[model samples]
Target: MRADAVSRAVLEQLRELHCLEPEQTVCCALSGGADSVCLLRCLLELRPVLGITITAVHVNHHLRGAESERDRTFCQQLCAGLGVRLAVYDVNPAARAAQEHCSEELAARECRYAAFAQVQADWIATAHTASDNLETAVHRLVRGASLHGLTAIPPKNGRFLRPLLRVTRRQVEQYLESLGQTYVTDSTNLTDAYTRNRIRHQVIPALEQLNPSVERTVSYTLRSLRREDDFLHQQAQAAYAKCHTGKNTLSGLETLHEALQFRCIAMLLEEAGISCEAPLLERLAALARQGGRWNLSGAVYAVGKSGTLTIETVQLPEPLPEAIPLQMGENRLFSGFVLHARLETVSPAENVANIHKKFANACLDYDKIKGEIFLRPRQSGDRMQLSGRGFTSALKKLIQANLPPERRRTAHVLADADGVIFAEGVGCAARVCPDGETRRLLVLEILGKC
Candidate 1:
């Protein structure tokens, strides 16, 4: 390719990044290294044609001591010479690592991205080349990565864009040479101490010997995997919608294909902001296939029973201490639920079975109530008459028979001086239930519990 063609190849990759709006400023993450220097130069050249403004930001991670400071100084000089505005952040990665309880590399990456986030730009550009992506894929694969990890670095991740993702490191060096530009090299990259460095120096070269164009081959494979991953992701989304029983719970996951089943569980975990590896996901699938429970990280637990999986946070709700007065046609808010009561004329089409079938809503015979109704947590000695029993049953017995133990404790009930008029998640008291001769009804609705 020609010199301009080489630069344009990188620029084309940048344009391919998602969410690249026109006429927005591009913040270049310049590290004074070959890949980043080439990225900054290409973005600067393309700025006028693409109708975008350019600014460069550099972070001094303070891990290499004076060498890191030298890199920062070089970035400042380069930006000044090119007339591009620059922002420099001085951060101590060791101190950050100590505070965050993470490795130095992770702390450095976090600090660098934090510095990028501080810049006011529409898109933050990074210099991750195809070579870096190949190395990352190989390293992650060795460490037991899934299909998503095999796809490697994304072109656009949130506000950060890897414009040189399709460009090789050799192309970056060639582009810089054509522009008569020089870049500082990080000595740490030459060391084999880090896994990524080991992969770049040892693993990738060994694979390249098997196939001379290994990087290109990996890049092509990654693109294909990305497309396939996207299709599977969409299928998983559709399957998840079907499996959804409620928030934090899914059903019929066991019936789904293993591919969709794993993705569905992963989606749920991600939605909860919880992290789980392939092993945990596989265990969860097994739980769905059979029946079991697991306590997961982030104070969450998963229970699989009867082909249904429910993931719940560890924080249980605290029931209200006192009874709440319920006024007709008014909404009452309790600790765990909201109650709304309104009087309605019983329609001829509405029957006892229909009213009792709606869990959140219940139609009670209005005339049978002798006092004001109150919404309260189930108290000991509470009793409710089953619709056909002709006698009141202990509320605890009713709840235990119908609801799980956890739900039974937190469940609320509607009551008056007469007795317990209705039990939550159970059914309305038999005495207060609407019958064929009932003219008026108290439509009570209890919502938003567990």
Candidate 2:
């Protein structure tokens, strides 16, 4: 294909991928390199036809001495020549690297994205080409990466868009040459010191010599892998929904294939906002296959017993506090308290059931009691009369029958002017049932710790 045709094809692909609208503002990340320069020039050329406004963002990593400054100046001049606005940010790459405890490349990337996010553009466009994706895939595969890493860089990630991923590096240079555009070349790109440069200059070419079209083949393979990866994610989600009990259990996990099992466990951990390392996952898998127990963050554990897997959170050392008084429609926050409350209306029948549960020390009807509901630490004299038993029982006896000894003192009780109406870790008073003519509803949700 001719250079112009290839350039047009790339531009069309970008236009489709970006879904450019005339009114939308696009921020193009420019480094004055051939790839970025070509990207900026192409977008400028298409602006009138696509009815979009273009803005150039140049992030000076301050790594290449005078060359970095020159690139920013060149980008500013280029944007001026094209009648587009330019935004420039100077970042201390070395300082950031030290602070973030990351390599210079990763620090620079983070700084670049942070700058992009600060810019007032609706979308940020980057000039990552197909060659970069191929390089990334090869690099990650060599490092023993997962399927997600093998997929490499996605074309669209959040507010960032890579419009040139379908294009080649040579095609970008050719397009720039056709427009008589000169771009700065970074000396670091030629050095073998960086892993990416070594792959770009040495590894890719050697592979190409064996198969001449390795880049294209790798790109196609990535596309296929991405589709398969998406399908596996859907299947994993469905499997997770079925075998997952309200409480953690590994019983059904053994039935799944090894790959799905790992995926399901990872998803579960992710949903729980728990970090899952590869070693931990392997340990969990080993425990599932054998009779052993492994402990993880937040005192959670996985144990294999009798060909079944069970994941459970360790019981808290301290007992939960009692339920506190909450105003109508108010949300309550209590430390070590399992029950939460909100006000809602209930019919008379529901009120009677609620009162019965309260008398039986089962549920708390917070609205039925008169006076202010206060939460206080358990006192020695606290007592409540059981409805069916017709006998007043000491709080200690009530707690012994229901909870462990460790929870006796830590438990709080809800009280009013009448007396200890509700035991914090237990039930409410039976005498405070709402009358039949009552119209208001109060809703209290009690959540138990896992």
Candidate 3:
């Protein structure tokens, strides 16, 4: 926050990167941390001279319970006090990591980048200092880096810009101190629980003894590595273009250098939404050169024949579960959620219409449903008249209109011998809706992940 004079170095870096164009807007990724606060304030102070607008964005991972809320509230108050537009994104990195089968750290980074992608601005600024750059490089080195992963953090990547790449974390603290700015500290950072925290707490300090300005030195080395990596990437792109014949087909991959071949394979897998280990990559590269079949990630397989390679994803049919009786108490359905069913003694004096509207997708008239009720995935030609909608609509049409595309495959319908009575996403059928005369109610509530 000790901006203006202190921000000259950052301004020069931005100018070199051509990031702060006149009249353009820059959205700062603020986390209510010292580094991010300094970056936001610095950008705000430099806004007038650079002829740019400054805004902020924050993503709350919600992993720290009360601390998460504290960070979010601090970001909001800080943005309001500075009169800057702020955008906030709530992300559950743990859930995303589980779904993607990746580490929570990687998931959080992906979520942050995704949030950055949503901003309607010329540039998205992140508060990554030289210290962070060193830590990232070390962490990647410890794990193993195949390509540009070892190059650590870049000053600019697409629309994302790290203005303080050259600035050290100590300098950030000094800047904020001079301006009397306060920032929140994440409690997790104080512990060495995570791999990154361990590296930051133990490994970096050891290296600092070797060179007092180790962060700066490491940063310079990483910059050079980044340029070399970028050059190789361009070569790989050109090589892929020449070898790529058509969809899922490649020819003359053996002609390219091994590095280019591996890089090309990596690019292809990424495009196909597949991730594999280095050993599998080596095997796949060999398969691409020679003619053979090799099992790849998930249901995907690499097939090479007649001096050509192709990726074939064997999509085994995901058969729906057999229709089951809608029993009382808890029922786990094919939709990966629990449906709690129970009978309640609802009086005629109760606001039946209000109850129907409130739990439209859940409740149904037990008396109206003839025979035993069964739950199954939506079938073709199934139609139902939804309560209050006043029209009979096809189940597929109703699902298309009401449910998100991802949820459509898991949508279920409750049916009896007569017809459909309720849809998972859509409301209950009008014939099964409780009226003012109804004395009992069959309440169905969806308990996700239960």
Candidate 4:
């Protein structure tokens, strides 16, 4: 194909996908390699026609010694020749790898994206081609990954866009050579230390030998799997919406087919801000079938009568006596409690009535509560009057209303210098309401162990 035709095909794919917008700034992540160089060339040629500005961002991972420095210098010259803005970031990938205790590949990816996000650009573009997708699919399949993993790298993920996903590596190299374009190649990519490299260098070639169109077939399979995966996700979402009652029940999940049940559980765990892994899912499934309870990572699972499943996270313990005071809009971990505070102003149009009823913990009218607020464990003989009822109740009775025994013991209560006003994870008091006419707005927060 002609260089112009190749450029047009790539640009058309991006435009159809709505990856680029008119007059919006785009950052191209240039590594001075063949793929990235070709991508940069194509975007530069399309810039004037599309009326968009392009900036080149090079993240020097400082891993390739002199070759890495050369890559940055080449990118700078390329951007200058094209009259595009160039930004460079130098990061110590080794130190980051050690700190994160992650593989060098993952650390480098994180560092590169962190640098890209720091640049002031609407979108970040990368050169991930069809070959990368094929290799990823094969690798994930070998590792026994689910459909989500087999789907591999998406064409568009978050602010990152891959305009070259539909193009093959051979096509990219040919296009560059036809234009007499010279680009660098990272030597690490040739090494078989990484699973992806092993697939690319060995496994894929063997598969292609069996069938010449294996790469294309794999890509098509991934696309179909992506569609199926998306449909399953939708079904799981519908199931979750139907079954979820307040935040604890697994009713709708148990009703689903086994595949849908696993998907629903994984989705719910993610929604609860808990990360799920293969082992956790297996343990959860085992717990569901064994008619017993098990704890995995951040969640607890219990199987009740008639195959009913209950999933709950352990409540965080109370803050320490020496726990630091939280400031507005700050999140801090004290003892076992996650203390988050935010300040907001109440407007005349905004409804501020009965805000205390929403939270089991105290939502003191910021103006009515005097002195600085403190968060600590419940003290003996701590007492407060429940908001709806006229009679006073002890903290012990208030906690028993609808809370598990283990959670109640660790629950923190909010208080002033006088006494406990609001028991965390329980109920608020009537005396804490803001006087409607005089009170403006105060900071209301939930202090809990996450």
TM-score of each: 0.68, 0.65, 0.61, 0.66
- What is the clash tally of candidate 3? 0
Better of 1 and 4 by lDDT: 1
lDDT by residue (160-186, candidate 3, tens digit) is 899998889988888898889999999
Error of 1 at 295 (Å): 3.7
Best by lDDT: 3
Candidate 2: give its CA RMSD in angstroms.
Answer: 16.3
Clashes of each: 0, 6, 0, 1
Q: Per-residue lDDT for 336 in model 2?
A: 45
- The per-residue C-alpha lDDT of model 3 at residue 219 equals 81
lDDT of 3 at 183: 100
For model 1, the local distance difference test gives: 0.84
Which structure is stronger by TM-score: 1 or 4? 1
Candidate 1 root-mean-square deviation in Å:
14.8
Task: Estimate, for each residue in 1-450, the C-alpha lDDT of model 1 and write its tens digit.
Answer: 468865677667766654656789999998999999998999888877788899988988888979988999999999999999998888888999999899999998988777777899888888999999999899888888899899999887888888887788888888888889999999999999899999999998899899988888889899899989989999998999999879988898868999999999998888888897999999998987788878886457898988888887777555456887778764554555666778778678877666556423477888898788887888888877777686777888888898888667667688888878888778778777777777788887766652
Better of 2 and 3 by TM-score: 2
- TM-score (C-alpha, index-matched) for candidate 4: 0.66
lDDT (tens digit, per residue) of candidate 4 on 1-450? 776766886787688677676898878899999999988988888888878888889999999899899888888888888788999999887899999899888999898888887999888889998889998888788777877888998878888888887777988899999989888889889899887888889888898899998767777787788889889889878887776665655664456787777776687677766677787776665566556766655445444334445666676544445423445665453445565655545555545455434432445566666677776666779888866788777888777775688767656577776666667656556777544542454445655555
